[model samples]
Target chain A: MYVQRNRSLSIRSRRDPPANRHRFSISTFRGMQQPELSRKMGKMIKSENSAIGAYEAAGRERSSIAAQLSDWGESTDDDTVSDISDKLGVMLAEMGELEDVFAQNLEDYRGVLKQIRNMESSVQPSREQRQKVTDEISKLKYKDPTSARLETLEHELVRAEAQNLVAEAQLSNITRQKLKEAFDIHLAAVVERSEKQTIIARHARRLLTFIDDSPVVPGDARPAYDHETEARQVLEDAENDLRGWAPSVEPIPTSAGQESRVNGVEHDSDGLTTGLGSATGAGVSQPMTNGGPSAKKQLEEPQSQSQTEAEPIAY
Target chain B: MYVQRNRSLSIRSRRDPPANRHRFSISTFRGMQQPELSRKMGKMIKSENSAIGAYEAAGRERSSIAAQLSDWGESTDDDTVSDISDKLGVMLAEMGELEDVFAQNLEDYRGVLKQIRNMESSVQPSREQRQKVTDEISKLKYKDPTSARLETLEHELVRAEAQNLVAEAQLSNITRQKLKEAFDIHLAAVVERSEKQTIIARHARRLLTFIDDSPVVPGDARPAYDHETEARQVLEDAENDLRGWAPSVEPIPTSAGQESRVNGVEHDSDGLTTGLGSATGAGVSQPMTNGGPSAKKQLEEPQSQSQTEAEPIAY
Candidate 1:
């Protein structure tokens, strides 16, 4: 019976190996039968290799072209040609490096394919042995309370999934934060630069307007000077006159219940004469107090003169 | 000869009576022949008026819709329906307003057209008078040594043209400045708002992460505590823990070659350090003195352990 069992086991092993081993055997048989497939694979590999070689050849050709372009002895416009040639040379070098990387990637892919094949072969077991292993696994399952283990694993899986979700959310939040900060910083910089440009443009426009509106001729005494120079001098003089005016040196009144002195007398909101006393003490003359009547007469005289003279220019 | 000329002028005047006059004149006769054209123009105006009315009606409807959508009552629900309704209202309102503006523009165009027609008719001198004026102008052109008045007018024209060119250039510069300023203000406001929002979002995310990672069981925690509060507490705790252990303070050297005291630092560009020495003191305890080393070690150990444990959790 032992001899029969042993023979039966051997026969079973011969008939059906482990699943992975069967797969490997089947693949091996398929490979042997279909030489065309191997040939096609080999052709693909050769084409890939040739493509890499072609890339390298192209790189070399580009390098040669660059070298020829850079040959100052052969060309009179060396500076321009050499600059272009140098750029091309750098590009060619980069292309060569890219080709190398591509070749390496292809080799790595080939190795991974080989490893996958090996794994497939290694996973295959004899049919009888597989059956025995399945029976043993069933027996173990019956003896052990696998439901508890499965429940634990399921719980752990849920926890892990929740953790993963949290982590992903956090990562996304961080990325968004970084992007927002960068955008804000960029925007601020842009706004600042634009503001500076705007100010410069405004000043330039003011200068242009001043130049455009300036009088063509100065006073009769300085009529011999060029119009632009005279205008500029007039502007300079006006500016100097303005600068020469002294700021008030009088101390501000600190009297109790008195309104604060801002340049001159401060008026109440009601448009009344509440703050008139403060101005009297200061040396500064108040137009409202002394020149009120005469100023009004002067203003009317100008208006009458303007109205009379207006019609003469109309025709 | 004068009597003959007067008779001819009177005859011409009688033949070409103004349109406003009761009697028909040659010019008025020409205008009367274009009755069909006038009718067509009237019909066009009527159609335009109707179109404008329709546009105004549409505008009113859209404006009402927009007002309703933008009202405080509509913003209560943070749902898709409310959003869609608001968007639709805005679009309808915009469309209506655009229609109204279009109608107004058409009316304005019609008014301009009528004004142009009136100007043309008013400026159209009688044919005989126009000929006489042309003859006089030609005579003036043939006069020796052009009139001083004409010379002055020509100079004025040249000056006006130069002024126009300068004004145009100045206007363009001003426009550029205004555009730049507007853009800068807008960008600055946007940057400031965006930065605030980013900071808020970052804080929000950090709070969320803290809440999610807290060791306290959700069920065990106080049921009255809201998510926001819980998150805030977690953040506060984390901050306190960091403050207690982390040495983020840095020492800034004073200009007097004296050590400056700094405490309660938040973050430094380099690694954390302790306080600077006192101005007059020597052998002052710098960083890594007393509890510094132990605190750092304690902080580092837990962090490393947590990181190691987090690796598998991450995967």
Candidate 2:
């Protein structure tokens, strides 16, 4: 029972720089090819995918372990261990279910982040176009002061600058708005998970108390386990708590009003939404709703399991 | 924004029997090789390893994502987003560190289970020995009624029965005691993780509020980002809350007093603690102390980072 616990932060955290995680992989090469303006957000979006996958994997493993635990308990042939472990298995499985739900919430958050990355990717080309035309006009002026092509190039530069201006504005607006929306869902999911899991784990501890660890001598038999009713009650309490659970997070406010978006376009002569993909200020003109249904929506939604099942141990 | 969430319990839960997870793997073959008495606990211990590994992988990914987030924000060139994202990264990295600690705690719980498995494995041989002797004596009587080998085998049967009885008692005592001890650490770890993450996540939500998600017009600049003081305060608050955090779980009681173990031996005429390996009642008779420094000990331990560091963003 000599356990060497990892008391310090992991060595991997200290030695491996987080900025260059999995840098040699094919995905990293794709990331490297991204336009400079969009590179960082692109990388963050991809890393978020890995983060979500890890959570999904963790949830799957947790559920598998829960079932194995109950099966092991039944095999023990000891009545008390069998009953308590089976009940503990039920609680653990619920915890696994929570992990899966949390991962789903994170996936929503990841999608919101993708909006920003997509906007970044679109904006990069406009920025390059503006820079290219500006460079050409300057070069013509220096090389041939009287060249008629200089006037045409100057006009093209104005058009490119106007397009780039709209793109830049869309990028800034979407980036700020989506970033807030994403983490709002993310942090709320975190709090929801912590609260619900605390409720389950607390009840789970009660199940542990039912196990009588008193030792017995050779030939002495343990008394019959009669805690079945009490153990079953623990599962009932957990289910009720989960069913009653609600989001207790603070409301994250936003000011992305309709005026700043659509009016910003109609009022500004250069802020034409034409020529840009639908990504340009598409939703900005609308009133800021809780984008992508906040974690609160999921909590308020009814659970899939039937409320009429009187027995807690249906499985 | 169409989020098709897994609101229902996963389909895998309904169709895939928990009893046969990964049954075709090489590890499953190893599990099958275990003696019948120890097989179930053996499988359980292995599943716990996968569960712990999943958490470790999750922790690593989370920390990586946190750094990437901060890097992405810094590249945005918006002072407010940059400062807030960096602080948010710090909180997230802390959460990741908690996952690693939780995984470590599970490893301790897994170690405790191995003790029960080892005891079960040792006891299996004794049970087989007794059964073999009884069979031999019966077969000899049926085949050759006058065989002198029957008397020697009967004496061997008595000796085997005595050894087996001791072995059975040891198995039950160790199983119950260690099962309680193992989950005591485990459930406590769950509670510890839930409570601490709630603290960090609440503070992280505060960081999110500092993000000015107000949209801007085309060519209109955002106000100079100015939430630095408030943002840094959130980190300090989180660190302070974490440092002050403690275990508030209900204490699980154990009746594994010294008398039931040692006196159960001294008082029983048949309870000779011999023949079995030291696994038999070695430490059972000793006073029952908390096993493997429950989650409380780790909570009390000082963190690796120095309290004297005034700057929160040293990295």
Candidate 3:
């Protein structure tokens, strides 16, 4: 819409009460103090005040009548009351409209206050006064519209409005019930998800219980074998074997043959049996007295042993 | 307060010009003409209209004066204009009060309209009128105070009000700049979080790129023995091994050694080797007679050959 000029017709945001208000005169500023409008304003204020008082009296009467309807005695009946109820419904609508008018009127007057301020500060009697408000605004480090903080805040407001514009609009029309229904619906979804989670937890518990805690297989057969002990033995053997495989920081002579010479436990025959004598490998095929063609056969023969005594001799 | 019964004071919300108004006697309802409230309402209306007109005229005069100031030749000066500005400010405030009065007046008349409707339909001749609003409320399908929807709505409104009570209070004295500052602080937080997420993503990308593309293992020296691949291969192979070990849905014959006999694909020799006899048994110790005591030894010897020529006999 086309507006008057550089300024839109709106109130200047800061305003005090009317007791210190202006007289709307250019002649007074030019040395002629005009008091003509004062009488007019006074008369308006008086009439409006009376109108307000009368309006309030009327409202009190209506409310009083509504309160006393049940005491209307013999005249009160369903049909008559119903007919009046229709009119009451209309009155309620009018009441709502009246409330809106009050709010609108408040806004309009506030606008006028802002308008006066706008004219007071911006309408310069000379060219220099145009810069007055800008200078005043710049003095305020925080409230200045061009401040970095305000710029950042504007970005934030834009994002927030983008997200919650619907919510704000909804708020205007929102009755308590719509808000309840919306939240209750979400609550129900949460409850449903919780219920499913509870079912999942219940099933998991039942599944864990279904598996028996028993000593069964070291491969399903060696059930009689002490598999845990055997496993421990295998771990010990692997650890010892790994240590024998490489020198950590420097070149060192092989250790497996030394183990054989010292511990007398050489039984592996085909591979992983004896060392090649240096840091690297062309692995030696050591001989087994048990006559197994392969070292793996030799390893297996000892793994089946029931006692720890037989474990180190070959494994 | 006691009122003039059916003529309880008010201006009709849709009141026409003062030349025409109420026709309020009971016989008038049956079309007999009556004009009871013209005098009282007329005076109120006349005074209010005059006030409203005066307010507008003052505003127009101020606008006109501001427009004419530059042309006031040598007569206009800042101090003189400042004096008039003061007066304009007062007028602006008065205008605002006048707006409020208008709203109050409207409310008063709406109340009178309700009072008149109440007395006409429900009041007895010898007594004051009783309010029947609650009785009307109880009869409404949607408006009944006890309705579940209304209850839920009320609950929601209460919750919303409670949550927003701080916001409502803060807004009353809040300046635009203050609002901007508060929101700007929040925006900074959002920007910080976004920055953190960017850092997190950058670090994750760098970490993923750290490992070189080339393989670290020399698998040729250790054919059938990729330690890292063996780890992952062990995982894959173990999955396959387990599948081979268990019956899919029924109690069936064991399969490890059986695959060797049936598909002739015998290769692996872990503790998973089997005997297929009954409900349960000792694990299989099937003999390998292709000149290798250990199937693993046989498998490796063939894998080193790599030509795909010796695959069947060894594998």
lDDT of 2 at A35: 71
For model 2, what is the alpha-carbon lDDT of residue B202? 89
Candidate 3 residue-wise lDDT at A203:
23
Question: How well does chain B match by TM-score in each candidate?
Answer: 0.25, 0.74, 0.18
Candidate 2 lDDT, A1-315, residue by residue in tens: 112223232334444454744553233354446677767876776676666666666777777888988898888889998898888888888788788888788878877777777677767878888789878878888899899997677666655655566677677877777777788888888888889999999998888888877666566679999889998888999999989988887777765543232223321212212235433343332333332223122222122331222211100
Candidate 1 lDDT, tens digit per residue, A253-292?
Answer: 1111111121122323222112223322222222222222
The DockQ values of the predictions, listed in order, are 0.01, 0.29, 0.01
Q: Cα lDDT for residue B270, model 2? A: 19
Model 1 per-residue lDDT at A41: 24
Q: What are the fnat scores of the candidates, in the order listed?
A: 0.00, 0.70, 0.00
Across B156-197, the per-residue lDDT of candidate 2 in tens digits comes to: 665566566667777787778778878888888988998999
Task: Label model 1 with its docking quality class.
Answer: incorrect
The predicted structure with the larger lDDT, 2 or 3, is 2
List TM-scores for all candidates, in order: 0.18, 0.76, 0.16
Candidate no. 2 TM-score: 0.76
- Candidates 2 and 3 compared by TM-score, better number: 2
In model 3 chain B, the worst 10-residue window by lDDT is: B213-222
